[model samples]
Target: MSSAQSSMQLSNVSDPLRVHVPPNETPEERKRRIAAEKKAKKISEAIDKQLKAERDEMEKTRGTKLLLLGSSESGKTTVLKQLKIIHGKGLENEREQYRHIVHLNVLTAIKALAKGFEVNNLTLENSENDEHLAAILSLSSIKESLNRQSLSLQAAVGGLKSADDATAILLANYESVKAVWSDSAVQKYFESANDIGLQDSAKYFLDNVDRLAQENYLPTDEDILQARIRTLGVTEHKFDINSTTYKIYDVGGHRSQRQYWAPYFDDVNAIIFMAAVSAFDQPLEEDLRINRMRDSLDLFNTICNHPLFKNTSIILFLNKIDILKKKLNRLQLKTYFKEYQGANDFQSVTKFFRREFLSRNKVVDKNVYVHFTHATDTTQMRVIVASVNDMIQRENLKASGLI
Candidate 1:
C-alpha cells in the first residue's frame, strides 16, 4: 500500500473491478471467470498469509481511521450509506478484500445528547420546585454541548466560574456550561423552563432513535447505550489479524464540531482522508460546503506531523464524482465560490492543494494516493472498494516479503 502503484490494479475490460484468466475452451465469459478465480486466489494469498500482519497491525494498533469529513448535507451521509451497502454485503464478492466499511452517526449522536438538553431546558410555567433545578442544569449543559466546536469532553459538568456567577453569565454562555457539564441539573432546569421549552419534544427524539435501533420495535435503554458505545470506537480504524474484529475511529465534519477531529490521529495506523473534487472548482470562504475541504486540509496537516500518521499509509478519496460528472468548467464554479481570492485560475486550485494539503513528494505522498470515486453507481462503487482492497493487498504482500 506504500507505493504509488498501490492505487493501480488489474480489472476486467467489462468491469473496472474484476478480471479473469483466458479459458482454454471458452472465448470470453468462461475465460473471465476462470481468470477471476485465479486472481482472487492470488490476492487472497497476498492478503491472508503475506500482508496479514500489516493488516493485523492495522487491526491491532492504528485503525486506518477513515475520516469522512464534510459539512452536514454535503452528501457525506450518503457516502456512508453507500459504504454500508458495500461492506454489509460485498461489491462483487471478491475473496481477497479486507476493508471493513463502518458508518458513524455523529449527527445522530449529537442529536441524542442534545435531546437530553432539550428535555432539561423546558422550564414549566408553574414550576419552581427542586425537580426544576435539575432540569435547569440539564438545559444549561445541553446548550453548552450544542455550542461546542467539538467534544473531547473533559468534565461534562462540575466546573463553575465561581458559584455566584453560575446562575447568570456562565449559565447563559453555552461555552461556559460546556466547560463544566452539559448534563448538570441546574442547567437542565433552566433549559426546561417553559420559556426555553422542549421537554415534550425530547420524548419523541428518544422514542424515534430507540425504535429505529430495535428494528422497528422500541429498544430497551441497554440497546441504545450499546449503540452509543459502537459510535465512540471509530476515531481511526484499527485492525489486527489476530482477532476477527477491528476498531475504527471515524471523524466528524460538522463546522461546529471540527475540534474533535485532530485528537483521533493519535491512534490511527492508517488514514483515509475523504475529499470532494467540488472544492477544486467551487471553493468558498464562508460557506459550509467549502469549509469541508478547508477543514480536511486543516485536519490532514495536523495528522501529517502527528507521530501516528506521518508515515502511515494514507488514502485520499475524491468522493462524490457523481456530482462532478455534471460539472462543465472552472468558470461555472466561479459562482459557487464566494470570491476568487488567489486561485482565480484552474491551475491555482491545483497549486492551492499542492501548497496546502499534499506532503510535497514525501515517500508517504507516493504511497499516499488519490482515488476518484462515486459511491452511488454500482460500477464506480466497485472500483472504489476494489481500489482500497488492492491497497491493503499490496501492504499484505510487502509484509510477507513477497514484493
Candidate 2:
C-alpha cells in the first residue's frame, strides 16, 4: 500500500463506516481493487467535466440582458408590455387575456374621470341647476347598478362574456359626460391628477364604449397600448433578433417592490429608465405630497450612481409625450415647475426635460440615449424600439470586442 492510502486507512480505523482494504498476498485481489478505483475516478472526472460544460453553456446563452427601471406609474411596465406585444414569439394566444384587461381599463378610466371632476369640485351645468359630477359618479349607486347589469349579462350569456357590462349604461349618456371633460374648469382641475390618478386615455375609452361592449369584441392595438396594470414583481421575457438571443427583465417601481431589484442588476447590458412626461403635473399615488417627476428624478440619480450598474448603459424614455403635447397648450409648465422660464409649448417642455435628464446622468464616458415616447403609439414605438435594440446590440458588441 502507498503511504497516503495507509495513512487514510489508519485515520479512519475508528470510524464505523470505514472501508477495510486488507493487505492480502493475492495479486488478483490487488488487480481488482486497482481496477475498481480507476473506474470510480474516471466516472467522477466525467461527471465533473459534464457539469462544467453545462455551467459554461448557461453562461454563454444567457446572452445580453436589458432591464426596465423607473418610479411607480412612470410607464416601465407599459414599455415591457409593448416589447412583449412587438417581439414575443407565440403571443397571439395571449390576446384573449389582454382583452379582459382592456375592458377593465376602460371601466377604471371612467371611474377616474368621474372622480377627477368630483374631487376638484367641478360641476356639469345645465340650465336647470349646477349638477355636481360626483352625484352622477356616486360609487354606491354605480356599484349596485353595475352588479345588476353584470349579473344579467352573465346569466344570459351563460358566463361573463364581457368584463364590464356597466359600459353600456355609461355610454348611453356619453355626450353629456364628454361635454364635462371638455370644460375648461375640469381641464384645469386635471392638472392636479397626481391626487386623482386620472388616465390620459379617458376620452378614447369613453368614446369607444359601444365597440368595447360587444360580446365578440377583440382588443385593438390602441386598446392594448392604453391599458394599465400595476406590476407587482419581476417578470422576465426572452426573444431573438438576428439569431442572437436577448432576455429582458421588468420589475415593479413601487417603493415596496424596489427591494427585489438588486438580484437582477448583475450582467445587465442596458437599463431603460422610463419617466412619464405627463406626470410633471401629477403627484405619486403612494405619497400624495411627493411630486411624481421629482420621485422619478431621484430614482434616476440612484440608478446612475449605483455601484452594481456602473458599467451598464442607460437609456432614458420620456414617455406620454402625446398627453404632454395637449396638456402643454392649456397648462403652463411654469405652474408646476417654477424653474421653467421658457414658453409652455411641447417643444420647450420636451427640450427642457431632455436637458434636465442629460444633466442628471453621472456616468462617465457614457452617453444617455433619450427618446420622447408615447407608450400607446405602437407605430412610433416600433421605430423607437428598433433603434433602441440596435443601440444596445452595438454597445454589447463593442464591450465584447466584436465590433
Candidate 3:
C-alpha cells in the first residue's frame, strides 16, 4: 500500500466510518512532487557551489591590476604619480623629495638649448663664414656649466637641510648663464627650435628666477608636472576605488629598460599608454634620428598587437597637449612631419596625430580610449582618473560575470 493509503484509517465507532485519504494525493502526483523537490535542491546546491568558487577566485585575485606602458618620456611615471595624488598614500611627504628633480629639470632645459648650438653647427666668434672651420671643440664650457650645476644641485639635495639656499645660488649663477645663452650667435639657433628642443617651461622658470630662487620655494603642481625624470624600473602603486583594490605598475620607458617590461605584461588587466603629443617636432634623447612621436606610435602598435594582451583594455593618453597648444603658433608640425596634411591649428593637428596613431592599432573589435592630457594639471587629472576608475571597474566586473 502507498504511504497515503497507509495513513488513512477507518473510524470503526461511527457506523461504517469512511477511510479518509488526506487531500486525495495519488501515487503519480507524489512521485512528481518528490522529483521536483529533488531537482530544485540539486540546482540550489550547484548555484551555491558556483558562488563559492567565484568568491574564492575574487579573494585570491584581489582587485584590478592596471599596467602603464609607453616609450620613455611618454609621461607614464607622471600618470602613476597622479594616481598617487588621487588615490595613493604618503604623497604629501614625498612631494618634498622631488624638489631636487625640479632644480635638475631647469638645469637640463637650459643645457638642452645650449647643446642645440653644436648640433646646428653654430660656433662662437673667430669662426669666419668662408675663411676656415671654427674651433668647434672650444664649446666644452657649455657642457661643463651643466655638469657644475648638476654637481652643485646634487650636493645641495644631499647635504643641505633646505633647498632655498642652494637654489638661490643656482639662480644667481643663472644670470651669467643667461648672458651666455642670449649671445647673438646662440640666439639664431633658438629661432627655429632645431636639433635638441628646449622645454617651453624653461623660460617660465627663468623669468621667475627671483621668486623661485628663494629658500622657502616649494614646487607647485605645475612645476612638478613640467619636471621630466626618466623612470628606471618598475614602480607599483596601490589604491582602492569603488570597493575594489587597484595595483598600478609604472615601468621605465627607455629603450634599454624595455626588456624588463615583458614580465609584467602577463596577468595585467589594462594598460594606460602615454604618448607625448608635443614630441612630434622633437627627437628622442636616446636616438636623435628617431622622432619621439614615431617611437610612441611604434610602441603603441606593439602593445596593441601583443598576443599576451589580446584581451586587455588599452587607454591612450595623448600627453603634453598644453605644450602642444603653446608650440602650434611657434613651430609648424609639417616642418617635422612632411606627410601631415592637416591645418596648423590645434584641433586639426591633434586630430591628424590621433588618426596617425589609431591607424597603427592592429587589434580589431577592441576600442582604445584616448584622453588629451596635460599631466601637470591636477584638476584635469582628477576627472580623468575618476573616469578611468569607473571604466576599469566596469570592465573587471563584466569579465568576472558580476555585472
TM-score of each candidate?
Answer: 0.40, 0.72, 0.75
Ranking by TM-score: 3, 2, 1
To one decimal, what is the Cα RMSD in angstroms of model 2 from the true structure?
Answer: 11.7
User: How many clashing pairs in candidate 1?
Assistant: 58
Q: Could you tell me which 10 consecutive residues in candidate 3 have the lowest summed lDDT?
A: 129-138
Candidate 3 per-residue C-alpha lDDT over 1-403 given as tens digits, one digit per residue, 9 for 90 to 100: 8766655643324443443344789999778877887897899999999999898678446657888888776777677667777776625665565566566555555556555655566674433321211222232323443322122234435444555443544555555445544556655555566455455456666555555556677777666655555566787877776566888888888788898998888888898999989888777766888998999888898999899988888989999898899779888899888998778999999898889878988778776888999887888999998888788877877887989
For model 3, the stretches where C-alpha displacement exceeds 4 angstroms are: 1-61, 115-174, 177-191, 197-200
> lDDT for every model?
0.42, 0.70, 0.69
> What C-alpha lDDT, on a 0 to 100 scale, does residue 136 get in candidate 1?
35
Clashes of 3: 1
RMSD of each predicted structure: 17.5, 11.7, 10.1
| Structure candidate 3, residue pairs in collision | 164-215
- Candidate 1 wrong stretches, greater than 4 Å: 1-76, 89-246, 279-292, 327-331, 334-366, 396-402
